[model samples]
Target: MSEQSLFERIGGREAVEAVVGSFYEAVAGEMSLRVLYPEDLTPSREKLEYFFEQWLGGEPRYSERYGHPRLRRRHFPFVIAEHHAQLWLKHMRSALELQQIEREDFDSIWGRLESLANHMVNAHEEVPREPLPEDAWLT
Candidate 1:
């Protein structure tokens, strides 16, 4: 017989939803991450719920509803530098801890997500622009 999916091992749909919700809550606290999302995070939260559900091997709700994930392609618009990816993982790690999952299960999930976060980096950070010498500024 096949091994149980991470979804099942972690207690299925409700667990996934809880973890996703926690992840978003953590993400909300960070201004750097918060800037990437819309003011209203309801839609974003739902999308992540559906995505984590399928990604953890529960069901294909996300793909069925939104077509192929195209995760990297979809995230291309954002300038995801190394630090951004690390912050994303930090929030995700906190969310996973809130679930109190087993070590192996955590490893399985964490490994995949870490890879995904790193992969999402589409650009590097450039130096900040200098301010004009004059405070008066141009019209």
Candidate 2:
């Protein structure tokens, strides 16, 4: 039998959507990462779902709609430091945990995401700021 794609092994499109939702929930709960995402988050969630689906060997909807996934270029506007990458990975790890994915699959997916998140870092300068209120990101 042919080897199943990661998407298939992970339960396909619906699973991808669910993971994305869980991921965003984790992100929203993280003050450090929440501000990086848009206020509404719906569009970001959809885009992340498509991106993850394609990345996991499913249909390439993200590339089909958005062309090449120049992720670094796309994220240049954000102050994506190493701290941001680590926080992003933390939320993603939590999201994957909620799915009860296998160890090998989880490792594989997390490795790729860690690499991608590290590559997305564009800003090196320290983020000068004061302690933010709990709802500061909502603004």
Candidate 3:
């Protein structure tokens, strides 16, 4: 390839793998996010690594293995609220920093990811979470 892909710019598979690893490490402890993941993170880790590898321009392996990545559709089963997206991005930023991805390069990647995360927000806008008198807890 003439131009170096973002994958290459961030130091290819090894670096991407490390970043993804760091991401899950953070997620593993984050209860809000943790509840959303399976008890076994291995599959999630593998799938994400493959997807990122291809998305960042190393190989077509993710698509090859998983077919079309219907990301939103895949995520449809989850009740992804706004807070969840923010938490996801927060960990993503930490992961990128942990891997020491260059600011400029990471910025580009971060922007796209932010949009993607926001797009995954399936919940409605914030509303008062009050309960009706009958529904309120009996104190």
Q: Which prediction has the highest lDDT against the true structure?
A: 3
**Candidate 3 overall lDDT versus native:** 0.82
Q: In candidate 3, what are the lDDT values of residues 31-81, reduced to their tens digit?
A: 999998879999889888988999888896677877777676566656789
Worst 10 residues of 3 by lDDT: 130-139
Q: Which pairs in model 2 have colliding backbones?
A: none
Regions more than 4 Å wrong, model 1:
1-3, 125-139
lDDT of each: 0.80, 0.80, 0.82
Worst 10 residues of 2 by lDDT: 130-139
The candidate, 1 or 2, that scores higher on TM-score is: 2
Q: Write the per-residue lDDT of candidate 2 for residues 1-139, one digit (tens) a residue.
A: 9999999998898888888899898888899888877799998888789888899999998887777776765666578889999988888887788786788998898888889999888787444333333222211
How displaced is residue 129 in candidate 2, in Å?
19
Regions more than 4 Å wrong, model 2 = 125-139
Report the CA-based lDDT of candidate 2 relative to the real structure: 0.80
**Given candidate 3, what's the lDDT at residue 126?**
51
